[model samples]
Target: MTGWLDVHAHYLTDRYTQACTAAGHHHPDGMPALPAWNPQDALAFMDAAGIAASVLSVSSPGVHFGDDSLGADRAARDLARHVNDFGADLVTSHRSRFGLAASLPLPDIQGALRELDHAYGDLRADAIALKTNYHGRYLSDPAFSPVLTALDAHAAVVTLHPTSPPGWQRTALDRPRPMIEFLFDTTRCVIDLALSGTLARYPRVRWIVPHAGAVLPTLAHRVAFVCDLTGTPADLPTALGNLHYDLAGTPLPVALETLLKLAPPNRLLYGSDYPFTPAPAALQLATALRQSPHLQDATLDLTPDSPGATLFPRLFAQQGRPEDRASPA
Candidate 1:
């Protein structure tokens, strides 16, 4: 076995950052600055951290900037295409060490659908990376139903990443968005998915909740209570139970324990959150995951049989062949 398989690694390009900057997002998601990234640096970090392969996605503040004259929606779609192509080209170069989880510009139903086709069909991406919200709208919004429906049709592997929630400024208290808002926003989106019945509706869309289910394990019961109080009942537990979670951030005791209570151990996958997580911190998280007493099972090694690997078996096969990474339909 080479090492652990990481399903939540992130990558950035100078051009992407420049574009985001042009759109007035010099400090994306309230982070001080965007981390530098390239395949060589990522490979170095992965080798040091004992990661055999990493499924890469662009981090928060995804592809969209703000609405612009080029038409914010149109620009977003264009950028998503470019990002996916870049990722595909990267994977083509390093088929064994990396996998691409392509991006999509949502809330623009048609644009999203088009990009989804290109990402999965043309680029041959391994999975889909999505933000929790776009322009104050969340995955639970009815407007997203069409895109969600298409994902189910493909049985897509979807990773839900958190972004600054709409109006996060009021409650963020000037703290970094990743410090707290990221975790909370993920929970909020999961709750909305449950509340709006999106989770149940999109049964085939396998969801990979990041940061060890991020505040979701704690809120499972709270969501049911909220639904009960509002006289709008939803089977939140069943919905949450069906999803997969990546152990990205700090999943030592609290997050992992709570997550295990709601999700099965077999549904867990390893995540590094690199670049954004910094090499040292990411390595620390990786070591913690390896030594975690809670995950001493057979799947902990991140082999093909592991839950996360099951989502992208091609990447974890005994001799994974990236030659045909994503065969377009």
Candidate 2:
């Protein structure tokens, strides 16, 4: 229980500020833009929430947008390194209180590959945060193969963060729907990836879909029906079988229900989507985990690690052995 971890949090850095400033955007509370965040503040929040540490990354629309021009693409690379370097420093200085998900210049695939070399090879990121749609392209598109290939080669943890669909403009009156739309978008992108055989093609890459796995848990049967109806390959179950989901921004019952239908409790992980969603969600998630009858059967067959505790064996070392952690899902 002391090993509580928040898998979703965005810790802003100079590059994050520059990207936001460049886009003429401000922080949610209208707080003056920041060059970087204090990890100590994050530790304090973790203390308040009874969480021990958080896995950090840049939020949506990561530096790729800033790479608007050819010259900007180069700047994007530099900025990405800067942001990840800051992440490295944060974790190193804070000891075991934090982990990092490196940022990428996504749509710029070549740039992304280059950055991955450093982030994965050198920095050893716990995971990499990716948006379903970046700039104008869905991540399922073929052009992203190189990026996925690298991830597969490394067995990298790919944490999918939700971002609004391209051209989604919010009006003052309908503020919250954008978040809902983003969840749907995450679901859609995952479906697209599965339908396109991307998931089957890249078996080694570990995908951690956030937002309580978006809409997949509830809409899985419908998705299968339509895919089957349209003469689409019905390999979704295989794709979903190996995938993992972090319960961020999803209600406890909703998330648990989805887990029961679309996948197993073993693939489930706790994610708070912190700063955006607060500590209450984390407590709620824990409560749901303990109370959910759905997990009873799943938790029964403890291979080596408890089914639910295997993903981050490093963080949950007390619960299981490394071999159990490394066991195939």
Candidate 3:
């Protein structure tokens, strides 16, 4: 049980892959083609990387795949249901090794509400996964108030993943969106949520921001200054401090150092981002975390009583591995 608990892994069902293919979104957000995914392969990768368990979710370009209004919403609803059902099955089959962050069809409030109820009530999802922006609408927009209200009422855990920002394709940048724009979009969404008062209004919904808050460390002071100048009631620093972060891609000296400055050690969680991040890369990062001098004195907490444990207590409770359950605080 000497392994990490990965909070940011991804799972792609066969039907989900097909839906992406049909929508011409195989290389979603202009990244490389979707990687092959199977439960056995995922479990093997986790074992090889010393990952005790992984909380999975659908990744970028999510369920809303079409351009036509009616068609896209309908497709998103169906795909969300399919993906959730598949994820629920995985959780049931591999209770100790897997957890789920149910997907919702955003920008379609009614559809999202329906799926939320089904995911929380029927599937018993551990958390919810939301893109930084739904279509062209940011999460702070009033359009998502209903969804936010529901999640707030339940005191749910929400993980924010980056999507291709609007007009990203026209940027003329040679690199893929994930390389640069994904981080920017993630930053944008955080700022938007803070400025629009979503964080204040929905205090009970625990948030997990991936990729080490996606450049938030570098921009924290600047954002705080802007908030001051704008007369915004929200304090960017406080808002950011309250959220949990996942060490997904590369949690080395730079990323790790920056994150420590903004968040306490308990607020940090390990994330593999597997399938999207190949096993070798994920293993390398995990090894790096273990060897990092900065973490030498700190015990990596990944238990039900850890700082963000309330997000998915059931998943952590199923962690029968003694070492995992005994993770240092």
Candidate 4:
């Protein structure tokens, strides 16, 4: 099997995690604990899982912790800068094995915009990572228009990852949000993007939806029907055709089968959601995906070239084949 290019991998720097912990995210989004991560460990996982390269992003709880006090914006801005800088350095160190999808400090619009410019301009990120919602401000909110506009201007690859819902306390049922709420949040934000005409407004920006489209495959018709009845701008089927989906989580015969209903084979990309997923579980997922009989029929192209290169040609080369050289000191 060819080495897989994973688009949905995650990274957690010590300072970034420390900030989250200080802000009371001891177990972010109600996970077991903040998983340990480092460049060498990440490369080891890639080698073991047959991943040629991965686009890394700082996952849930994002950069801002919703502190409305004085100097909150400055704090958020500093943390976001730190995260992007750290990610940029990671890319510099392992140009072949990893790419940074710089995280923004959203709900703090000015700060986010600053990071966006730095991310695309200086850091030269492979993509921009945004949570489905920021401090209850969904991507479709008018407040996010500036961010979207800037991203469109750059024709950036924007990855939509899920975070805790505003009502997570009531909705999560005391279980980890990643277990279920994450998928729902992904679906909710995507439907919002379509219905609110967000996708239409940002045609130049390409979006990568994680977790096998996160219930989108199954809800495509239902969403489109509602939009038609309500006279909303949502054309879910058409949008699905345009956007990309990553095989991050348990996208086996079920999710994969349904996802094909809306997207073509080439639009599908591999993702490992690692560290957050725990290496052992991630390995099982990667192994299972490769061995799926149905996937064999799809002729899935897991190579380094095709689709990803078209989006992130700057960082998609097979630079870390041996893995040892790519490992950080």
lDDT (C-alpha, whole model) for all candidates: 0.84, 0.69, 0.84, 0.84
Which ranges of candidate 4 are over 4 A from the true structure?
A: 68-70, 297-305, 318-329
lDDT of 2 by residue, 115-141 (tens): 899897888777788888887589778
Residue-wise lDDT of candidate 3 within 24-80, one digit each (tens)? Answer: 987777777999999889999999888877899999989987654888899899999
Task: Estimate candidate 3's alpha-carbon lDDT, on a 0 to 1 scale.
Answer: 0.84
Candidate 4 structure quality by residue, lDDT tens digits, 238-313: 8877898899888885898888878887787888999888899999988898887656544333445467767767
Query: What TM-score does candidate 2 reach?
Result: 0.83
Could you estimate the TM-score for every candidate? Answer: 0.93, 0.83, 0.93, 0.93
Q: For candidate 2, list the clashing residue pairs, or say none.
A: none
Candidate 1: minimum summed lDDT over ten consecutive residues — where? 320-329
Candidate 1 clash total? Answer: 1
Total backbone clashes of candidate 4, pairs 3 or more residues apart or in separate chains? 0
Question: What lDDT is reached at residue 293 by model 1?
Answer: 84
Q: Give the lDDT of residue 70 in candidate 3.
A: 88
Tens digits of per-residue lDDT, candidate 1, 1-329, equal 37777889998877898888887778987888888898889999999998878899988899977653358888888888888998888877777777899998776778889999998888889999999998889898887888999999999999889999989989799988999999999999988887777887888999999999999888898888888899988778778888888899889867898898888888888888999889999988777777788887527455656775678876766334534345322
Q: Give the clashing pairs for model 1.
A: 124-326
